[model samples]
Every structure is written in C-alpha cells, then in structure tokens.
Target chain A: MEKIYTRPSYIREGATSGFCPGCMHSTVHKLVGEVLDELGIVNKTVTVWGVGCCILGAGYTTHDSFGSPHGRACAVASAYKRTNPDEIVYTYQGDGDLASIGIAETIYAANRGENFTVIFINNSTYGMTGGQMAPTTLVGQKATTAPFGRDPKQHGYPVHVCELLATLKAPYYLERVTCLDAPNVLKAKKAIKKAFQNQIDGKGFSLVEIMSNCPTNWGMAPLETLEFMKENTLKEFPLGVYRDKDAE
Target chain B: MEKRFMKGAEAIAEAAVRAGCRFFAGYPITPQNEIPEYFARRMPEVGGVFLQGESEVASINMVNGAAFGGTRSMTSSSSCGISLKAEGVSQAATDHLPIVVCSVMRGGPGVGPITGSQQDYWQATKAHGNGGYKLLVFTPESVQEAVDMTYHAWDYAEKYRNPVMILIDGVIGVMMEPIELPDMVSDEFIAQNKAAKKAAYAPGPREDGRKEKHPINVSDGGPMGRNHADWMKYEGWKENETDVEFYQTDDAELIIAAYGISARIAKSAIGILRSEGYKVGLIRPKRVYPFPTKAFADLCPKKIKGILDVEMSMPPQLAEDVDAATKGAIPMEYCLTSYGVIMNRDDIVAKAKEMLNK
Candidate 1:
C-alpha cells in the first residue's frame, strides 16, 4: 500500500522533541519544517531559537539553528539576516519570549524592516515555566502565578501582538491564526507559509502569531483545551490577517 | 602601513576591519561612541555590515548570532552598557562562540561617571558573567597597542572558540596618537576564514554532508557535565594563552603591576624613579584573564621589596590579582583613584617613593 503520510525531510528522524504533552509547540515545529522543506530552502535557512518551550525546536530541524536568551530571538535573527543577506532567517519565539522580555527587540526589529520571519506561538501561559502568567494571558484566565484567575486591575490585560505589530509601518505582513482544530490548523499553516514567503520575496518583516493551546498548563485535557481555545481564546485573540501591505 | 594620528576608538574600529571583521553591532555609549560611528561609514565600504543595535543587550546578542553564522563579528560599549550585555556575553561563552567585545570603559558601579576609569578591571578579569567562564581580556595601554591587539583578538577568539574582550578606558578611547595600522585584510581572506570555521558554525552540513542535529545549548550533557566542560575550556585558556609584557622586572627592587591606561601612567612613574637611581619595574599584563600568575611567581621575592598595584579605581581592583599572584609572600601596595579621575604619574611616583622608604 502507498503511504498516505510521511514526516517532512527537514525534520530530524527519531529525535524526540521535549515539548510537554498537550502542547502545540511540536505541531508548530512540524509545520515549520514542512514549509521549509517545501520551499527547498532548508539548507539555506537559519532558525533562531528563543528561550521557551520551543527552544528544543532548534534540534528538531535540519537547518542550521542557534538559540538566543529569553526574549532576544528577533535581535539575534536580525543580525543573522543582516550579515548573511543571501540566506533565509527566521525566529521561533513564544508569547513570553516575544511579548514580554523581548518586546523591545521584537518591536525594533519590525520597525527596522528586517527581512525575516517570526513564528510567534501565543499559548497565553508560560508553558515551560509551569503555566505562569504571560503577557498574552487572557483576563479571567487561570495560571500558576494567577491562582484566582488573571485580573485586569492587578495583572493588566492580554497583549494583542498582531494588533500591536500591525501598527508598525515596515512590516510587510502580520497575521493571527489558531490551531485548535483540523481546519484551523490548515489556516495556521497557510499563514505561516505566507510569512515565510514574504521573507523569501525580500519583503521586510513578516510575523504569524499562532494562537496555541497549553492543556497541561491550562489544567485541561487535550481535547478540552482545544475547545476552550476555540471558544474563549479565539474571542480575545481573533484569528485573521491584521495587516498585509500586499493587500493594499 | 603609514603612521597616522588616529583616535583610539577609530583605530580599534579600523583594526577590526583590517582583522577581517565583517559584522559589527553596537549601541552608542559614552567614550566608545566613536567606534560605532567609524564603523557606520567604514563597514559598507568594505562590504561588511555595521548595525547600531536597539540596545547593548540586543547588540551583543546580535554579535553572538553573527558569530554563530560564521562571520567575524563584534560589539562595543562602556562599563554600564557592558553590564547590560552580561547575559548575552554569558550565552556566547556557554555556546563557545567566537566574538570580540570592545569595552572602552567609563566610570561605573552604576554610571558613576562618563570619563576614563579603570573601575571595570575586576569585571573584565573576573565575574564578567555567571558560570565562571573567563574571557581572554586584553588591556591595551596605547592607541597603537589597542589597534594591534584588536587585530589579533579575532584570531585568538576563533582559535579557542571563545569570547575575547579588548578592555580600554575613556582616556585611550578619545585620545589621539600616531600609530602604524595593520594592513587591510582582503575580502578573500575574510571568506577563507569563514570557510575554515564553517564546520563549527550553525546550519552546518558536517564534513560527511550530514546535517547537524544537536542544538548548541549549554544545558546539554546535564549540569555536572556542562559545568565540567565549561571549566575545562577555561583551564585550556590559562595553560596556553597567558601573556604579559615586562619592563626591567628582573633586577628591579619594586615591581609595578598595572594594565590599560593605568599601566601607561605606571610606566611613566617607572622612568622617573629610574632616573633618580631607584630600581622600579613594570609588569604589564596584555592578557589579564590568565592574570600572568606565572610571571608573578617567576619574580625573585628575595630581591623585590614589594608589588605596587596601580589603577584608576579606589579600593584597587588590580591589587586583588597581584595579591593572589604573589601569594602574599611579597607585600602589595595600591596607588588608586575612582570617580573617572585619570591616574596621575606624579601620584604614582609619590606612591613608589613611599613604598621604597618602607
């Protein structure tokens, strides 16, 4: 019988990912690898790994990979692309890495129009750190640090990264998508591909903010977490293209 | 090359280009601003990249990334800015990435002053980062030496796959002096250097054409193994790379231990004391991290009266190293200042006389 599915060639075979069960990080990593393999740029691509649950993603791909300290992936990726302009460069950052500690680097890289792609996984809570409150944590959401649910007065509000980055003039594309279900996962793949294509086309600065689930951190089963993200997380971080200069 | 009167900061930037540096990312800080300014105009001309990074933190990380990409990369900042870059520097050390960091130090302890200061000696020689990883620190006493040291810094960095720091002060950074610069490195040379180290760089196609599968994370090999390997690298550095320059140290009665601008001032005091029939010597450490402990051990404690540790910082940071090197067999005295004050040769002379009278 002919095989109906196979792992992307760009993904390392038999290497185990360290992402927690019920986490969306591995799915995103697989999608990114598939996209890179499809584009035939795996050898020429360099991925900057951010400090988060996805940090292990560096070892999962066949591309050259380097890790930056928490929240500095964009800054590091900018240097990689600037110095090696002919190569493709991208950063894989989590919400805490991009929206919090690395906000300055993320914003400035976008403003400078650095020709690169950013795959931002917004899973609300800091997954690797045991579900602590993150910048993208929704109001009334429960976290390890927010035992009584996140309060708008005390913990402030969830950051809409797509909206925030969309305000920048230099970014060629900015989109927010989710992977709660099969259909949404397909949409997220398309968004991620577009972001990578923007960089390939020499368009400056493209980011796809992926609304992801953290079932282990969210204290729910995998299926329950998907439902919760579809019902609640999607309302706060609605999935759509926030900005596309090409559409203009 | 022709001897040209160049400012210390400009000389360092030019030397880096001549050393085949093709990527520079730095933020403007007092005393070292001229470095980034010079590179801004010069890098493009040499087909290299010069970026004024968003902050010292970002700039250092950028240098780390460029270094990982197989390019000769660097960053510059003063003391306070260097403090901000400690995390990135530590990361680079952990990954064994080769990058040059130019710390043209101003007074610190928290932006204490913007003028020249040797307050960062302790920071550079020790505690540059957590994990106890040592930097091969070069303290240049003059613009010419600064240029020469900056040129060779990349080679040492790549040789060990470790970070190398060129430690200067605001005085040398802004001061102008005549210097013969190194020959310009050809683009071909830069390309060859990058190709030579391609295996160690990221996105690697290994020698057998297999893709690299392991992430360059320091946390690999568990905590114990990681720490052991990290220190092994430092041990290798101390064994093979320790360097110092001696001036009349063999027959001298008193030896002056100093570095950077303070060493220059100490040299002047040595000359003045020698003219007056005093036998004073200078032990200037070109590479401070290895700390030249062997050189200090080689000194005859029977002939030497004392070690005079001179610096431009109060509570004399260099004295700590001097005391350790001499193992308390020979007494050490300090002629020190802080708050961005330049070390005066006359004060050093006075201190030398006082130590002799004792």
Candidate 2:
C-alpha cells in the first residue's frame, strides 16, 4: 500500500506542541512547515519567533529557529535577511507582538522593503497573557482587560494590520486569511507560501496576517470561537488580499 | 602600519570594519553620530550592511539579528540612547551573542547634555540592563586606545560568546587624534570567523550534511540552569579577562584611579605632580567589568597612602568598585564633574595634593 499522508519533515517527530486545544497556532505552524518543505529551502530558512504563543514554534519545528524579545521579531528578521541575503528569513509574531508593542518595528521593516516574510497571527486578544485586550482586539469585544467590552471612547479602535500595511509602498505582498475550516486552512497555507515565495524571488517585504482563534483565552469552546470569529471578528477584520505588487 | 588622523568616533567605526564587522545598525545621537555616519559611507565600499534604525531599541535588536546569523555585527549610541538599548543588550546577554556595542557617552539621568560625560560608568560595567548581565567593558583613555580596543572587542566577544562594550565619553568621541589603524581583515578570515562556532547555532546546511531535527530553543535547560551557567562564565572573566595599567604606581604614596577620558586628565595631573617631587601615580583600568580589583590588591599599603577617584560625573561611580576592591582599607577622595563638564587637570592636581597632605 502507498503512503497516503505524512507530516512535514521540518516538524519534529512525536514532539507534542504545547498550544491549547483548538488553538490556531498548530494549524499555522503546520502551514509554515509545509511551505518551507515545499520550497526546499528548509535548511536555509531562519525563523525568528516573537514572544507569545508564537514562541512555541521553536519547540515544534526542527529548522533553525530562535526567539526574539517581545515585539522585536521584525527588526531581528530585517538584520538577518540583510546580512545573509542568500538565506530565507521570516518572523512569526502574534497580534500583541506585531500590532501593538512591535508596530514600529513591523512598519519600519516593511517600509525598508526588507526581503523577508512576516507571519502575523491576529487572535484579537493577548492569547499568551490570559486574553488581555490587544491592538487587534475588536471594538465592543469582550476581553479580560476590557471586561465590559472594548469601548472606543476609552480603548482605541482595533488595528487593521493588513490594511495599514497596504498603504506602505515598499511591501511586495499583503494578505489576510483565516484557518476556520479545511478549505480556509488550505487558503491560508497558499497565502503563507506566497509570502515566502516573494522573499525567495528577491521581492520586497511580504506579510500574511492569519486571523487566528484562542479558545482558552476567549473563554469559549474551540468550536464556539470559530462561530464567534465569523460573526464578530470577521466583521472588524475582513479577509482579503490588501496588496500584491506582483499582480499589478 | 600607516598612521591616520581621525576623530575618535570615526576611528572606532574604521576599526570595527577592519575587525571584520560586516553589519552595523545604529540610531543617530549626539557625540556618537559620527560612528553611524562613517559606517553609512564605508560599509557600502566594503560590501557590508549599514542601517540607521528608527530607534536605539530597534538598532540593537537588528545587531542581535545579524549576530545570530553569525556575522560580526555592532550598534552604537550615546548615554540616553544606550539606555533605550538596555533591553536588546539584556537579550543579547541571554542569547550569548557575540556582538559589540559602543557608547560615546553624553551626560544623563535623562538626556542631561550632548557633550562629554563619564556618567554611564555604572551602566556599562555593572547594571547594563536587566538580569544583572555584565559586558566586558573597555574604557579607552585616548583616540588611539579607542581604535585598538574596538578592533579587538570582537575577538573577546566571540571567545566568550558575550557582548563587549567600548565605553568612551563624548570628549574622545569628538576630539581628533593621530592613530595607526589596523589592516582590514581578509575575506577568508570573515568566512572562517562566521563558520567557527557559529555553524552550531546559525541556519544552513550542517558540515555533516544532515538536516537539523531539533529546535533552537534557549529555555531548554530552564532559567535557573542557564543563569547559573552564565554566572560561572562571568566569574571566569575575573581571572582571564581583567586588564589594567599601572603608571608609576610601584613606589607611589598616592594613586589616582580613573578610566576613559577622565583617565587622560588624571594622567596629566600625575605627570606634573611626579615631576615636582610629589609621590603620585595613576592606575588606569582598561577593562572595567572585571574591575581590576587585583590591581588594587597588588598596591603596597605601606607606600600607598590613599587613592583619588577622578571622573566626569556628579558623584564618582568607580568609587564603588574601588571600595569593593580595598574593602574600606584605603581612604578615597573624589574630583568629580557632571553635565558634560570636562574634568579639569588642575582640579585633579589640587585634589590629589590635598589628599596627600592629610
């Protein structure tokens, strides 16, 4: 009998990922692994992980990966890619890491057109910090920090990272995708692959913002958060290709 | 072998490039702005990377990234800017990255002045950042010394897999002086340096040609385990890395202890006083992190009456180390200035005479 399916060789065998049940991190990690393997650049790829649930990738993946201080993954990736132009480098950052504390790093790196990929995980809340309201936290959404719901009058509006980066001229690609179901997960993988491919093609900065879910942080069942995502989160952060220089 | 006239900050940049530093990311600030300026022009000629980060924090993090890629990387700033880089410095310490940081210090509790000051002595050698991490701090007293120290800093950094700091004040940073610049490192040396121990941690194909299967995680041994290991590494530096100079200290009844630009002022005082039959000398600490406590221990108590701590800070920072070294056995005096005030040679001479008379 022919083998039907196999895990990407980049992921460690029998290694248990420490992500919470129904967390989208594992799904995104799988997509990255598949993309890296498909490109045959797994050996030359360097993944800089932001401080959050994203850091867990360092444990699950077998490639050369390391953790940067919270919100500085983009800066780190920029240096690595510039110094080692022949190698592939990317940053794995959460919304809190990429959109809040690290917004400047992310923006500047994209502005400089650093040839690197950025996998941004927008989970609305600070998943690693017990569901605190993040920069991407939806207005009127309930978070631990926003117990009564995010009030725009007090707290700021949710940051649309893809739309914000779309205004930058240097970015080569910018797309927002979700991993809500099997079909959506495949689409998310395609977008992530293209982000990496743009770097491989010597294109400028590319970012794929994955609309993720945190069941544990959201205080809901894994399945319940998926429904909530479509009804609420998607309304604030619609999925689409915000920018694609290649298409133009 | 050719001597070149250059500013202290430019000499430092040239020395770093000669020492095989191929990546530089820095933010522009007073006194040290020449460093990034020089790199912007020179790095392109050498086929190296130069970046002016949006902030000091981002610049240092970029250096961290380049260092992790197994390149000789650096970042520089002045006192207040160095404060912003504290976070990246601590992260580099935790990761055991071989990166060089230069501080052409200006005055500061917070942006006090743009002129020269030795206010960052404690920040450089003692509590540079969180976790009580220490850098192998080199305090160069002159422009020539600054170039020399910056050139060799990368070797020490890689040898210990730790950050090395070149701590000079704004006085030296702006002053022009003649110095012999080292020859540029060859391409082979750069390749060998990167492939030496970097292959183990950097991404790419392994020498054995086997694909990596394990993640490059820093917390594998737990925080306590890592911290204890780092503590041992720091302790080893005391014996192997301590560097100092004893200038006519053998038979002196009084010695002036200083570092960097303040040491240059103290030396002038020592010269004049020694010629006039005053039994005064100087103890210059080249590397301050190890504190050169042994240099103090080696001083003969019978001949040394007291030590004068000279610095361009409001209160002396090196005095804490001097006290720790002598354990209150030696009486100490301070001739101090602050807020970018250059230390006066006459004031140090007066302070030393007053201490000797007592």
Candidate 3:
C-alpha cells in the first residue's frame, strides 16, 4: 500500500499561519506528520503539545492533540495510554518545555516504559518566550537573556536529552538528529518516523531529539542560525542516535 | 433497616463499593486504611481499578483524573492526609468533578493522635477552593447509611458534578458492624454505565483512524479562564440552594441544629427534653451541605428563647453553624464537643439547662 501525506492527522490547514516564518515548529510538525503518515498509525494516535510553543499546536495537527502543562505531558500521556490500551500517544516538546520544566516527566515517562513517543525539538533557546537560556543551550552560549554568555556557575549547565534519556529503560528508540544540514534533516525525519512506528508496535516510549536552529530567537539571521548550530551548538550538543533497544 | 450491626468504617467502604464504585485510589493512613484494604481486593474481583498511590496528593489527583476518565473514583484519608489533600479536593469540587472522598475522622491540626475525632466539619461545608463552591457533604451516623450513602454519594456527585464527602467520625470508621452490601452494578452492567459516562465526557482522538486527544480537562474547576462561563451554568446546583430535609419543625417552638453522629446523639437528648415538657426537637440535616434551612424559616431566629446545635468536633463546630445558620436565633447554645461518643446525655442535659435558662 502507498503512504499518504494528508492522513487523519489533526495538523490541518493554516496552522503554519500561527507561527512566524522560519519557525522550527512547522519543520518539527512536518517530521511528525511524515512519520505518522508512513507508519499508517495517524488515526490510532494521540498527540500532546508539551506546553510552550506548541500550546496551541494541537489546533494545527490532524492527530488527536492534548495540550499538556509545561512538563506534565508525559505523565498525563502515561495515564492516557494505561486507560486506552490500543491507542498510540506522542508528546512533542522543546528543550525548555521538556528538559527544564518537565525533567520529571521526561525521565519518568521513559523510566516507566510508557508506550508512547516523544519528539523533543532542541533549538537551544526558549523560542516562543523570546530566546531565553534553555537547559539545552550550548554551554557559554549567548542569547537575549544570557547576553554575556551562560556561566557554568550562576547559569548552571546545558543538558543532553538523548544522553540523559538513554539511561532509562522505558524507551525503545532514542536518537538525536538535526535540521541544520540537508542530510541531518533527512535523518531526523527518518528518526521521527521510526519513533512513531516503534510506538505502534507497542515498543514502549521512544524519543527523537532534534537539534534545530531558531534563527529569530538566536538573534541571528536564518543563515547564521545554521552556522551557529555548526560552530557553537554542535560543538556542545552533538547530534547522533544515542540508543536503540531493537538493535541490541 | 432496624437493629443492624456494622463497623462504622467497614460499612462506609462496603456501602461505596456496593453503590457502583468502579475506581478507587488511596494511600494508607491509620484508622482509615481499612477502606483501601476493603476495596483493594473487592474492587478487582468486580472488575474495578484500584491503585495505592505514591502519596495522598497523588491518590487524590489520580482519583480526580480517573473521575474525569468517567468512572466513580474515590480516595480515603485521616486528618493529616486530608490536609495534604485540601488543594486537590478543593480543585475537584470547583471543577465539579464527581469524586467521593472518605475522611475517617482522626485528631488533627498536625499529625495529632490517630484516634477518632470529628474535626473536619468546617473543611467540608465551607467554601475553601479557589471559588465559592460547596460539596455534597453527607454525614453518616450508622454503618448502614455509611454504606448506603457511600453508594448514594457517587450518584449525588454525578448528579451535581461536585465532590461528595462521607464525613465519618473515627467512631464510625473504627466501629465494626454487619453491613449489607447493596445489589451492585454487575460487571456486564458496568459496561453500560461506562458507556453512558463516556458519552457525556469522552475526549475522542480523531476520525482518520488516529486516536483523538481530549485535552486534559477540569469540568469547571480553575481560574477564570476558558470554561468559567460554562462552569457558572452549574449555579442552580449550588448544594445549599437546591437541597434539604425536616426535623419535627412543623409545630416545634425551638429546634436544635446538628448532623452526623452528633444529631443521632441529639435525638436522644431531645427525646429526654421533650418528655420533660420542653418543646424542643432535633433538626438533623443528613445532607449537611444542603442544610435544611427552609424547614426552620421563622424558627431560624426570633422564635423562642432556646435553640441548640450539637457536634463532636473540638470546642464545637455544630454549635457555631446553629448560630450562623439561625442568624443568632434564640441566642444559639452549644452542647460542647468531645470526640469519643457524640454526646454524654448528662453533659447534654446540663447544656440544655443552660439554653433553657435563656
């Protein structure tokens, strides 16, 4: 059977209108859509917008959208899956949304073996909130809030999502991909699709952490955002698949 | 009906399970652990869900989630646990989530003794959440009503979409008795109940073979946000406004305000007073929140020289309401509060003498 672009996803018309041009949410949504479409699990899926930028992301998607509190998407989805045994659940979160606010949710959902997928978009800054320092911000990186560069003392350290989540047993798929380059973009798409497929097979929690560029929030032009990803972000938060239970 | 034997706490738990409860979450606390213990095995046997939560906070929130998930969810606590639960309970009531909370009365203000005490009346009837809301608060005197109302509490919760509490004093939850479990909603029949429930509140996934996500919900509980106006529509359901009962208020010159075991004890005291030619009667509102004010219209105040309220809460909460609810009627008098047995007839007789002197 042939795969379809427009399936039963709730990500429908004009949701792209809600975001500013060059916003990464659309790219992330596209990756999510591409996966759900190819896997043929779009209908059996429920999506949670893990606070922040995707608060209204539920309105854009064609899948079932549940807007989770800043960090409670995974916890809510945990109970959601337990109640609806046959359904697939996915949580879309940004670094600030998942890593900082929802650290408990992020770690525990993976640790509990909850049958779901989480697409973590790491732009290294709080995009919707005007480029604040995220838990995933490259150490010593400068942003609007951390204008003088993030200090290891007062500002703490940047977290690595895939590395941190990799330690948990709940996840069947764990990967870090990026949209900074064409090939990385393609890999991130494949990773997103794989994560969703893993969930459809009842493989438990899976996460695809995408290191993407936030040109506007990074106070850089679109091109600089990509350059910055390579020069600064990549050096600090490297991109790669960190774990795969099936491969083991 | 007459002359039945039941342990106060067991009857409350059994009555709830008998009354179509399908979900329960709890954390064990002394005196009330029997509720979770009683339902844990029994619930699974009847195809229900039960989880001993990480803490009282989790237990209450989990029940809140399960209630919104469309099942009869309940939680139990003693004094300290109930305090930790104030936020969740208030949220549940404001959201009008039909949840049943059983508070097995224990000494309070901070991990006091685990022994029996009826000190939570203020928490139950007063508006304590983020909004001006009340509960479908029921006080059960006997084990039979404890069981019967435990089931009835679920129905009332659904009917009003509010938190319904069975405020059982320690004496009630701790005392043992032979409780008759009502005919239950059969396992197959539960499917029908669930279907009906899901119809009213299910958040569907999507039509295209994808699960539809129903946004996590608060039926009406929260800050004045998305559904504030929609929640206001439940105004007619404000417990105090649309519900009630009557004592011998028809020809009585004076009435006593009381509820729960205090009322049962008051009835005995009132009977003794009446025989001695005192025109006094016990006015117990079984539904404490829906206080039967209508029955005492003129008698509310400016009636006679004597009206009394009874309770077992420390220092006396029942007496305070008798004064407030009556607008200082006949200069309301209190029989005092001592948790052990609701009343010492001799002590109540002394208080009655004080009220009559006025």
DockQ of 1: 0.60
Which candidate achieves the best lDDT against the true structure?
2
Q: Please give, for residues A1-248, the per-residue lDDT of candidate 1 as tens digits.
A: 99777898767788878777877888888888878878877777777888888787766666567788989999998988887788888899999999999999999999999999999999999988899999999899988899999999999999998899888888889999877778988898998888888889998999999899988888898989888887899999888998999999
- Looking at every candidate separately, what fraction of the true A–B Cα contacts under 8 Å does it contain? 0.60, 0.59, 0.33
lDDT of 1 by residue, B5-38 (tens): 9999999999999999989999988989999999
Q: Which candidate should be chosen as best, given TM-score against the real structure?
A: 2
For residue B146, what is the lDDT in candidate 2? 94
Greater-TM-score candidate between 1 and 3: 1
Give candidate 3's TM-score: 0.79
Off by over 4 Å in 1: A1-4, B204-210, B213-226
**lDDT digits (tens) for residues A1-248 of candidate 2:** 99776898778889988999999999999899889889988878878889988888777777777778889999999998888888888999999999999999999999999999999999998988889999988888889889999999999799999898888899999999999999999999999999999999999899999998999988899999999999999888999999999899
Interface C-alpha RMSD, model 1: 2.5
**What is candidate 3's lDDT per residue for B82-158, written digit by digit as tens?**
87777667666644568899987776657877777777777777743455666767787777778878877877787
lDDT of 1 at B185: 83
